[model samples]
Target chain A: MWRKVLTFGVLVVFAASFLLAAPVTIHFWHAMNGPLGAMVQKLVSEFNQTHTNIVVKADYAGSYSETLSKTIAAVKGGNPPDLVQIYDIGTQMMIDSGVIVPIQKFIDQDKTFDVNTLIPQVRGYYTVGGKLYSMPFNSSNPVIYYNKTLFEKAGLNPNDPPTTWEGFKEVAKKLTVKNADGKTVQYGFTSGLVGWFFEQYMAVQNALMFNNENGRAGRATKSAFDSPAGLRVFNFWNDMVQSGVMINGGPGWDNANGIFASQKAAMLLDSTSDVGMMLRQAKEGHFELGVMALPHPAGVPYGGVIIGGASIWMINTHNTMKEKAAWEFLKWLEQTEQQVQWSEGTGYFPINKNSLTKMMYQGFYAKHPQYLTTVFQLLMSNVTPATRGGLTGVFPKVRATIEQALSKTFDHAMTPAQALKWAQDQADSAIAEYNSLY
Target chain B: MPRKYVPYVLLIPTFVIIGLFIYYPAVMTFQKALYKISPFGNRSFFVGLRNFENLFNSPSYSQEAFTTLIFVVASIAIGLTISLLFSLLLNEKVPGVGIFRTIVFSPYAVSPAIAGTLWSFLLNPVVGYVSYTLLRIFGIHSEWLTSYPLALIAVMVATIWQNLGFNIIFFLSGLQGIPNSYYEAAKIDGAGAVTRFFKITLPLLSPITFYLAIMDVVFTMFTSFGIIDIMTQGGPGNTTTTLIYRLYRDGFIYFNSGMASAESIVLILVMAVITFIYFKFVQRTVHYR
Candidate 1:
């Protein structure tokens, strides 16, 4: 009996060792939580199915910040993952680190790997100094999400959505309902504290937010948005917050979506990627939903939202085989068919221009024409560096500065000018501190 | 020699683990502090105290440092006092005291993230029943996180509530260990309840109090980032950007590993000095039996 047990144990150990050596598992860390996480798992399963040599093990790594932290820790520990999904804000830092194997380099090695077919705006974001470091995976932009039910209930035309800033305010004023006790029953609008969205608003007005090629060419030398025009936008937002027409809830994108889904708020400014979740929730609650271009100051057609989403990058800290495998996966992801599939699964815009015209995408666009608006917006966007996503090593910290300043203003601790000045000063100091290191 | 070596052998595992996991990383972290290191690739360049120089000059660091102090001081002081008071009350033979003790200590079992989420819901403007009730009753509809004074208060409240249970359990155990003979003697001396507490109970409990104080201070300072991350995310415009939170932002968000390393070293030094000062001065006042 003892001899038989010993033989079984040996076999088990040998089997485990063989399995461990079967194929190197590529660790793919991402911040796709909830339904998006499930979708990512399915995609990985498909990848593993098609490519038996490289087993892609996709793991959820909390939010964007947490994933970045874990990746950095793993890198320090000499156990970095093969692939990582990093937000656009972290591009400069990742590029400066020189640890990421530029996808451009990898693609160049493989002639079949072509990136020229992708949309210029999408490719341009990942491309630094004309070399793409990553493949755009889940690109999104902010758009106006409104509750059509609320618009109709307020005796306004639901079809004609707010087109301009002033129009947005007038519609919001009508939609905002007060109770018998004079308490606001329904808020007309809610926008979270996001500098990017505000930047988009300014962009529509053909205004500059920063200098030194908007930190695209190099490190930002100065921030130029501290102008009277910029202050006017903030002032208008502040007035809305004070008037109870809009709420200044800090990064309440989820909250605003919930409110809009439940017909509590008339409109919400949020990311396009959230359409899947919002649509599902709206369907469940039977709420009438509508979409429009984010309100710019009426006459400004130049206001285009910069992309906001994660892009997959191959970390070079891994072994050679793992790097090659990661490169293969990224190339596969860039394919038009795969891009279309991914966009269909999530509400994210397809990076490949061809994917936009794919038959399946055509059917989706036919049913939801508003979903196709993002593609048009990107196409029409001014190719100026300012209209491109803002670049800074500490962009997340800069966003927090906006959050902090807006929150203070919302709490009435400081006026719009005071908050803006403080935020700019704080952001400038943070930028300078970050620049000193590099 | 063998007998002496037996004791050394017992200590070896702990020392090895600490040296490898804690001390080694700490040393490397200190070294990394003196350079410009990014996570992706090129080895950091030696910048010679430049990161520290820049940190002190930055408003974010200064503000975060100050806010960290506020968070640590407020959380520890308030948490200790309320927990101590609750411990004393639960120590008494009151009605359903056992159940009360269990309930008070229950929140300690919850993760800080869970606590933050629950508190956020409870304090949310539109949906939070607690805040809604408070507004209706008081005629004040202030944003708890928006109001700067109230924002820290909200953080402190969550920190205190989440941590009170752990401190209560500690104080309760300490209270139970107290000799009944001391109380009997006080009773014989016709000492009032308050007098007996101050004279007999307070002096004797000083050792546990000192331990709890040190533990609480360290725990509060180190772990405040979790609550801040979850509850406020150092928001309302950097009102709650604690030291550790800023460390997280600098390291992870900005990907400035060098500066993060420097900030961490500064944090370690600050914690070490504070601990040393406590042992030097406050420990003398402990009056352990």
Candidate 2:
């Protein structure tokens, strides 16, 4: 009887070990914070619950730049997370790093997964040399979010927003409000001194930012945006600031949003990712918000917008089990249902093409029409190399130079031509240096 | 273990820690300054002083150096003067002195980033409380964080505010250490308050002042990154981009580690020279006894 009992106990222990199968734990570092972070957590927990043999430990890894820096350090220290969310500008740097395994490898190996299900424009940005390096996660494009209430008060049609540079200026002048003292109480437009917006403006004018087909065909050795298209953008921005119809929202996203939310400014130029937050802000501020496509220069065909936001990349951890688990999580995130959920949760539009046809998305769009505007704007965009955006390891440096030029131009310290020229020179040198190194 | 080597044995952990964390990194930084490292540091080649040459020749480096000079000098001069005054005031025997001292020293408890955030909201051009009040009362609207000079001034203001408590604490201690008998003796000798302050107080406080000046220089040079980052991000045409902030941008953001390493070396040299100048020239005026 004692022998039988001991054998039973050993059998029970073996059954428990086999049934449990110690789930593979994969670390994921993301830059999403606030509401977006919550959604990521929710999705991660859902994935964990569904996949019995896998557990994803998600970490909020500061901002995009911080996340990239931390990931690089971790990779060098030989303990990088299995997956990391990198911003759009970091794509070239990641590709040059040569530390990541292209997600295309997994896509090709998995028989059930279809790469075509991903949105073309979204996927195009992450694709280099005919191979997708990362999975397109939270993709966005810039749009004009205007105060409809302010527009109506200014005697303009609330339904129709500006579509051209000239029109935007005219609208800005009309929307600006001032008292008898001539001190302006409200400005017509404001935007953060973000470099992404300048890139989008260049794209909408069908202009490449860097040489060698916007750095897609080959390594970029020089900046290409100092041309007429670039000047047009700079001149327009300068005109607004000089006319006193626009407020310098400083730099970064929050201040500009503050200016808009406080009703000090009537319109804001920001990423489409702010749709969810902007809608809530409008409600709290007792104003109606209007969304429109980014304006192009008059008489120039719209080239569309480059995708902003970030994508998730799988690092080469040399552990096949962990790699497989990370790929499974990525595939699950791109499903139509999950994409719809992510889109509804965050203002970032869905990257999965089939998410648009889903009933959930249709309902979401019906409730929040602003989201549809962003989606349609992306869909209508021309699939040009310019729209696909520039690629360079020195994008952050180039962006900084452009922002400085913008600041100089706006403050009348330099003419738009001179500022763009200086920016072009600085960008060229940075790119040249990066190319020489890598 | 011999008795003579006991102290050395006891210090082994400290030496090992410093060697691993501090000395090793410093040596690595010096070595890296001579090499052109790739973004992820996977590829590197010896460039041999080219990074330093490139930095010196760069247009922005001179501007950054100028900005750094202004930031350090102004922060030290202005911050020390104000802190000295506050410390002197709080040194007096008065009701609620403890509470006042605590209130005056509260800012030191706030982290630089939090202090910067607070100041950012206060100075924001559109909806900031300070800006709104200024506009409402005087109709003067200044872009505090976006304009060139104003952005630097804003960062300096936040930094000084955050560091005031620390400066005050040191000054207060120095002030307390001064004997009241000195002031009484000066009064008996027909010395006026101003004369007494200059003749006795100033001379006696020189040592602390000298130490503070050096500390303030190092603090402004190295630790103002958080304030500048949160405030202007070295923007408005890089008006606020000091050497340290520029180092961070080059290394972490631009991934030009070689240039960053060179900048770090220059920073170390700058610090060393300043310290030498203090000990050689400025130390003559300090009255330790």
Scored by DockQ, the top model is 2
lDDT of 2 by residue, B1-289 (tens): 4999999999999999999999999999999999999889998999898998998998889999999999999988999999999998998999999999999999989888898889888988989998899889998988999997899999998888888998989888998889999999999999998999899888888889888888888889999998998888898889999999999999888878889999999998998898897888677866568
Worst 10 residues of 1 chain B by lDDT: B36-45
User: What C-alpha lDDT, on a 0 to 100 scale, does residue A294 get in candidate 2?
Assistant: 93
CA error at residue A39 for candidate 1, angstroms: 1.2
Q: DockQ (C-alpha) of model 2?
A: 0.75
Q: Which stretches of candidate 2 lie over 4 Å from their true place?
A: A1-20, A359-362, B277-287
Give the residue spans of candidate 1 off by over 4 A.
Answer: A1-25, A109-114, A255-263, A317-324, A359-362, A368-382, A411-415, A429-438, B1-4, B39-43, B58-62, B94-96, B179-203, B277-289
- TM-score per model over all chains: 0.89, 0.96
lDDT per residue as tens, model 1, A1-438: 999999999999999998867876789999998878888888888888999888998899988878877877787678888899988788877776556788887767888866788888777777777788888899988888888777888899989987778998999999888776777767898766676677777666656666676777767856666777578777878888888898655554554555566666778888889777777776887777777777677654554567789898788864787888888787777777777777878888888767888834469887876677656677777666756667777677777677777777777889989988987887787777667656
The digit string of per-residue lDDT tens for model 2 on A369-391 reads: 88889998998998889999999
- Candidate 1 C-alpha error for residue A96, in Å: 1.7
